[model samples]
Target: MSTDTSTAAAAGTQPGGGTAVQGHPGRLKPRASRPRRGPASYATVSAVAVFVLAFLAPFLIILVNAFKTSADYRSHGTLSLPSSWNWGILQDVWQRVDFTQKLLNSVETSLGVVVIAVVLALFNGYALGIGRIRWRTAFLVFFLGVNVLPQEGLVYPVYYLFKELGLYDSKLGYTLLVGVTYSAFGTYLLSSVYASFPRELIEAASLDGAGRWTILWRVILPMSWPTLSVMCIFFFVWSWNEFLYPLVLLISNENQTVPLGLAGMQGQYTSDPTAMSAAALLGVIPMVVFFLLFQRSLTRGLTAGAVK
Candidate 1:
């Protein structure tokens, strides 16, 4: 019995009948097992999965049906695979809507709004944030108030004002209106951003005999470019998708944008779902391309701001 107990001690077994690992010289305790995930973890994962599916369902439906033929769509419904890819429907919609002109119009309008709005936001942010002018809070509040005002409330007044100025139904008029209106929100946003900027740098620039405009152009603008670029992306997409203002202000077919072009596809009594989906797909392609091209910029800007 003593010989057997001595053998067990050499093998890293405790005299109390507990087992010990024997890899090391001294007896080592056994490693504790990892904890298993509980029901709450599974519940969280399931909720996220459900949200993702819900969000993607419409886009998936649109994509699947976009290539389907009219007969295929009616026969199998939106969820089924296409019998044959009806690629010609896209071309048909394009020609029917004169989509080339619509695309150009959208590009022009969105870019125009971006340019005007960004410039305005820069100036407003500088004055409100850096300048530290009197009643700055009041001005910021007023700009915020402008954002809260509904577009519906201002439509008639804007229409009348444009009509009086002989700018009604003109692309220039619509661009200007949207630009100015959007700049209010831009100003509000940029002012808060600019307020957080380093005052030491501004003071140093001023000590070096730089005027406000010079300092703004050289220092603030360069440093804040990422934020501005992200804002430009947002403004471009927003303006591109705008339907109501364009419909009300731009009466001419030539001035109509991509969204208007898509809506024009709807018929009084009948509609082509396949062609409609094709047009939507076409409309979505540009924004997707735009986002892909600028995705790195967006990521960098967001991360930089977060770190700051």
Candidate 2:
């Protein structure tokens, strides 16, 4: 009995206070301690916090001031909270600017651009990346150059070109112009993505009697949908926020977009800051709501292509 007790004590007294498992010679090792965070980690966290605060500051200011009256804005200053929550200002601004029509116009233009641009980009990407067209590098470089060309420089030419085509000052003209311009970058982006697509899959599809179009529609598009979705979101948002082109091209108030509508609120001599803030807030709401709705898709699409 004493010998058995001594044997058990010896087995339990292993290195690092580990205990021997019953029916097994191996001992259970102690858990490792977590590493302490150094100053660098804290500094990184602090920098991220600062950036978040900076990004949120303007929106917070806008929110607070949107609820303030002109008198309250002047008295309490920009950062202070409003004495009363003036919900009527939003409605007032909406009615004053004919925002409902502007909202519809913006939505129409943005969606049109997304459809035209995504289709254009997909075709371009397939031809360049899969077709392996001659002068592909040169074509890509040209697209890059076009994307970098300032809109300011092209404004006059575009205006003249559209004027000649009898499309100037029309929503269709604006949509087509922006869509083509945006498609340059999209083409460049998607071509690179398509280049990395699996040749094995393409060959497999072909062996199964799939033509190029069939493969593109059935195989390539299915795999590439995530990237395409991301591009759609980007195109929509960018087109929605377009100001310079819309300002130059859209002459009729009936065809003007949200950004244009927002700009029209500012008077030459006596602009109401509070009302401007309210207008700004209204302009931002649609985009915010859009992002929220597509937030999951955006996140998934962004990471989908990263792995393969």
Candidate 3:
């Protein structure tokens, strides 16, 4: 056998090789792997660029015109930059819309929703995901079903309920409703995050004589910051842009949010393009600033579930 192998090597032939393609023994060459797919085609790249520009064009136009005087906006065209910058446009808008009070309302209500939703999600997730609770699947599904049921379906009922509870047209009512509306989704997200937590750490914490809440607040929460942060961003954005609840439940200008304020501005200045543009840009500023700030945490939270 040894002689045969040595002879095959010397002859540059193997049992698997043809005479024309002979190779040394024990040096059988491996087949090449399929080549990696290259980047997207030019047409694909062009289409994506067109889509991005199409999305950004209107936003950029709005942003630029927001700084223009009404005269410039009318004369220069909607897509063009302001002929001369007017920083006062934002201030004028602030006065026109009573922007300070409305802005305060938005901050209060948005934070209210965030705190209520995320806190509930944390406790609820700890219970259903990490606790020894029974029929948690049923509970989860019920919450999901409740969440998927459209707010439009419950609008009148919720309105009447809030009215009866003396919470109608109040920030608390808006916060509670909006927070509860999204809380189910938050709970669903947090449950998945909690369930996959290291069981050994939990067991070790349990052995350390920590109370249930203590274990959750100290051990689980520190580890759960990424998920919690992402939920905060999600809930804040949702609450910030929430139109229906504020539109329906909040009647007074003082209680209305940025979106509702914009709607009012739209009615008041249906012809003032520059003012409207400024209002539109200002409405979304908080959301943009918020997402930019927590973007890293949001990214980490999103990818957390992908691994285990």
- Model 3: which residue pairs collide? none
Could you tell me the C-alpha RMSD of candidate 2 in Å?
A: 3.5
RMSD of 1: 5.9
lDDT of each: 0.90, 0.92, 0.84
Task: Compute each candidate's TM-score over C-alphas.
Answer: 0.86, 0.92, 0.81
Clashing pairs in 1: none
Q: Residue by residue across 54-85, what tens digits does model 2's lDDT show?
A: 99999999999998999898898998999999
- Residue 93 error, candidate 3, Å: 0.9
Q: Which ranges of candidate 3 are over 4 A from the true structure?
A: 1-48, 306-308
Q: Per model, state how many residue pairs clash.
A: 0, 0, 0
List, residue by residue over 169-210, the lDDT tens digit for candidate 1: 898989998888889998998899989899999999999999
lDDT computed for candidate 1: 0.90
RMSD of each: 5.9, 3.5, 6.9
Say which candidate scores most in lDDT: 2
Query: What's the lDDT for residue 286 in model 2?
Result: 98
lDDT of 2 at 276: 92
lDDT of 3 by residue, 254-276 (tens): 78888888888766435688888
